[model samples]
Target: MTRTLFALNPGLDRPAIAAALRAHGRVQVRQFLHPDAAESIHEVLSRGTDWGLAWAATGKSGAHIRGPELRAMTPDARARFGLEAGQSASKGDFGFLYAQYPMVEAYVQGWNPGHPLDLLLEHLNAEPMLGFARDVSGIAEIIKADAQATLYAPGHFLTVHDDTVVEEGRRLAYVLSLARDWRPDWGGHLNFIDDDGDTIEGFIPRFNALNLFTVPMRHNVGAVPPFAPVGRFSITGWFRDK
Candidate 1:
């Protein structure tokens, strides 16, 4: 695979973006990455990586089943596992079904010695990317970020919740959309909710767009129905101060 930069787009208008963020408390930067980098990221996510299933049958914290081990499960065993998870979701318990590549965990634990996503993880915490995050967010206290690649495939979703990990020093949450050829009708929208649990607004999973918002805001990712043609691919994480 070609080495990717994960660099922000040189053409970005930083002042304009900063203003938008100031005004809206959230902003989406389209064509957020350099063209080649975005292309490489999308390619890697779609073809060159192993994916693991992530879900939580009860509360907010999720457990994962790695891809290879999940594949090795007997069909009935797999079905039973999924059915249990689905049943929890049906009961309105916090549940989700999606694929993820846990970037920060893999990086720190030496899970894959030279994995390509590791490069991206490091970039998120280093130099210009870190500095850019501080500048735009107007939160100079932000020191680093954690990242993970996410794929919302057909029938996958996330329930509503605010990102409130105070112990983790999370100051802002971000999602960089890499999904291409995704349709509005296909679901997979990042939606914001009000105190009443009604959706106030939503953003489509558009290619090469970045969304950033202050933490502790109510939000959820809408499910991608089975009829969708592509997975909603993205790298999501929180900028932290601690």
Candidate 2:
């Protein structure tokens, strides 16, 4: 998966992604592939990440997943890296996954990577994921890249919430779905709340699909399932710091 994704695009999609998030609350960016990228990424997530005991009481969750020398892991691959499972902030029924890549800690913290991170960066820059800051929040040009993965099981839900708290130049909130060829009977949809915190803009969560939205708005994922065994898997992250 990681290898395929890396081979698909290479890096992030700045303009298109920005437009999608700005217009539709989220966007699904395509990924390129590399031979062993996916398997290696999963290995890092499963054992290399050092989740420690903090994740025991909680589930796999974090703020930064993509950074320099970083690779996003897959479900089957994460077992080797040490994956954690936990409920959403508002709802406990729906569980999510989390892990962090410290190699890019410096990049997410402050250092600028050059231009906006896109799929094109990997082969081009010394750090493919490194790029200029451009999301929302408007503060520092470069900020920490806080990202993570989320999986929602049956009867699980993430009550509406927003992702804009850190002050940075265009803070980014994104989610990439991993579940493939699934039916709607599967629960776990991200609902974007309007300004009044009522009404929904959309409920998106497609495979390899990336949704980027500015913070400050309310949103959530879930609604349990009346069907059989169908869950939601994706990676959610924000470009910011504590």
Task: Highest lDDT: give the candidate number.
Answer: 1
**Candidate 1 per-residue C-alpha lDDT over 1-242 given as tens digits, one digit per residue, 9 for 90 to 100:** 66456888888888998899888778889999988899988988999779987877764467777789888989997666556667777887767778988898889889887877998888888988888888888899999999989999888888787889779999989999999978899999999999988888799999999999888888889989989988999999999999
What TM-score should be assigned to candidate 2? Answer: 0.54
Where in model 1 is the C-alpha error above 4 Å?
Answer: 1-3
TM values, all candidates: 0.94, 0.54
What residue pairs are clashing in model 1? none
Q: In model 2, where is the ten-residue run with the lowest total lDDT?
A: 115-124
Q: Report the lDDT tens digits of candidate 2 across residue range 1-242.
A: 32332333456556666566667655546542242543333333433433311122134443333433233555564443223333334343323333332333434554434312222223222233324334322334444454443445554455555654544533566665555555656756667767766656555556555555666657776555747375455545665434
The most accurate candidate by TM-score is 1
Candidate 1, position 205, lDDT: 93
Candidate 2, residue 30: lDDT = 50
- Give the alpha-carbon lDDT of every model: 0.87, 0.46
